[model samples]
Target: MDAIVALHQRVSQSRLTAPAPDSIQLDLLMRSAARAADHGNLQPWRFLIIEGEGLIRLGQLFARVAAAKKPDITQAELDRFTAMPLRAPMIIVAIAKCQPHPKVPEIEQVIAAGAATQNILTASFALGLGAIWRSGEMAYDDTVRQAMGLSNNESLKEQILGFIYIGTPDADARPARQINPKDFFSTWTGE
Candidate 1:
């Protein structure tokens, strides 16, 4: 698919099914992700591929975290947290491996990691695969991060950017809505 077409029409596929992107497709997506722009050449991004039993363990970890917090969370609440990873056949946990850099700030590293994730999303669309970027409380929960083997700390530079779910869309994705660039663009004048 043409890059412009992919960029213009890419939409999040929330209801994904099995038959996730094959090895070749995954290779392409990873390559695309690696191409994301970075300042100071500090490629501060990494990914963890989770599927099969790994997904089950991830779900269990989420449940454990939730249960620890509330201690009285209902069964349904635990199930909901546990089922999150099962939403997709495959998930790539995008993490920012940010480190102290005199020339580059932590925010820039995080943005670069986000750009890498965007590349994966766009590439998935072009490859006829469905993808969604999902992150919420679990993503920021220190316990969850520790379960993922991330460094333990209140001010850790490394953090989870998102959990990118990729698979075949269960149904056709909604059409992309075109918004006028003029609405968001303007000429800046130094006054």
Candidate 2:
């Protein structure tokens, strides 16, 4: 697919299935992510690729976190949390590893990581694969961060931007929602 078309038409695929991207495709996705806009070249991001048994382990972690939060969590709720990671064959955990940079603030580094994630999503669409970026309470939980080997420190910011789920689309790609550029874009002038 043309790059422009991919950028314009990419849409999140919620219903995904196996098999996940092959090694070559995964490499392409990573390369694309590395090309995201980075101010001062502060490459403040890392990704964790999870698949196969790893997905099960991630699901377990999710369930564990949920149970810890609510001791009264029922079996059905635990099962729901456990099955979250099984929605896709593969998951790429995007982490923003923000470090102190004289030129780039922490927020810029985080945005760079987010751009990397967007690149991954666009590349997945271009490669004829399905993907969705997800984040919720689990993302901000310190336990989940520690489980992912990320720092839980309040000063040295390290955060999970999202969990990018990748696989074959269970259904056809939905049409991209149309929006008028005029609504969001306008000329800025000194008034």
Candidate 3:
């Protein structure tokens, strides 16, 4: 598929099924992510690929975090939390590994990571696979970060930019919403 077409038509697929992207498709996604614009040449992003048993571990971590917050949490609630990661066949946890840079602020570093995530989603569509970027409260929890081998220290940014769920689409992806660029953008001129 042409890059422009994919960029314009990409839509998040919420109901994904098994059969995750193969190695070749993943390579394309990774390569696309690597090209995200970075200020000061500081590539301040990293990804943790979770699949198979790794998804189980991630789900357990989510449930544990939930239980830790509410000691009386019910099994149903715990089960729900556990099933979150199972929504996708694979997950790519995008992490913003910010570093001190004279010219680049921490927010810029985070944006770089976000751009990489956008590339991942677009590339997934181009490959005829389904993907979605998601991050809820659990994503930013200190315990969750710790479980991922990250510290809660100030330096870590403490942001799980996204958990990119990837899998085969169970149905046709929703059509892109029509939005006129003219309404969103315009040239600036001093009047």
Candidate 4:
């Protein structure tokens, strides 16, 4: 598929699934991810590919974090949280490295990581795989960050950027997106 069409398809396929992306496909996707623009050539991004037993470990961590945060949560709820990793065969944990650079700002590094994530996502969609980027409390937890071999200051959580879940589609495609460029466009006319 052409780049434009593939990108559109990828944007529309931002959904999670259970089937995992193969090793070869993942390598290809990573290559695409690495091609993203990086200011100062810092390439301040890394990925931890989680699959098979790793998912089980993540699930356990998720359950622990959820339980600790909400003691009143029922076993069913905890189980649901634990089962989240099972929704996809593989997950790419996008980590942002914000080391200070002389000419590049921290935000630029973050944007580069975001671009890498988008590359992975677009490559996955072009390869006929379902993918989604997710991150919230679990990604910000100290214990979870430690498990992923990341250390951080008290104020910063080391920015997980995203969790890219990949798999084969198990259900019908989701609803098509309606794109209205006019609503998002702007003009430079000095008014």
Candidate number with greatest TM-score? 2
lDDT of each: 0.92, 0.94, 0.90, 0.82
- lDDT of candidate model 2 versus the reference: 0.94
* Candidate 4 or 1, higher TM-score: 1
Candidates, ranked, lDDT? 2, 1, 3, 4
Put down candidate 4 lDDT per residue, 21-87, tens digits, no spaces. Answer: 7778878898998999998888878999998999998999999989988989999999998988887
Better of 2 and 4 by lDDT: 2
lDDT of 3 by residue, 61-179 (tens): 99999999999999999999999999999999999888767789999999999999999999999999999999999878888887887644655554688799999999998899999
Give model 3's TM-score versus the native structure.
0.95
Ranking by TM-score: 2, 1, 3, 4
Better of 2 and 3 by TM-score: 2
Q: Point to the candidate with the largest lDDT.
A: 2
Which residues of candidate 1, in runs, are more than 4 Å off?
A: 152-156
Model 1 shows how many backbone clashes? Answer: 0
lDDT over C-alpha atoms for residue 82 of model 3: 95
Q: Model 2 clash pairs?
A: none
Cα lDDT tens digits, model 2, 72-121, are 99999999999999999999999998988788999999999999999999
Off by over 4 Å in 2: 152-156
Error of 1 at 64 (Å): 0.6
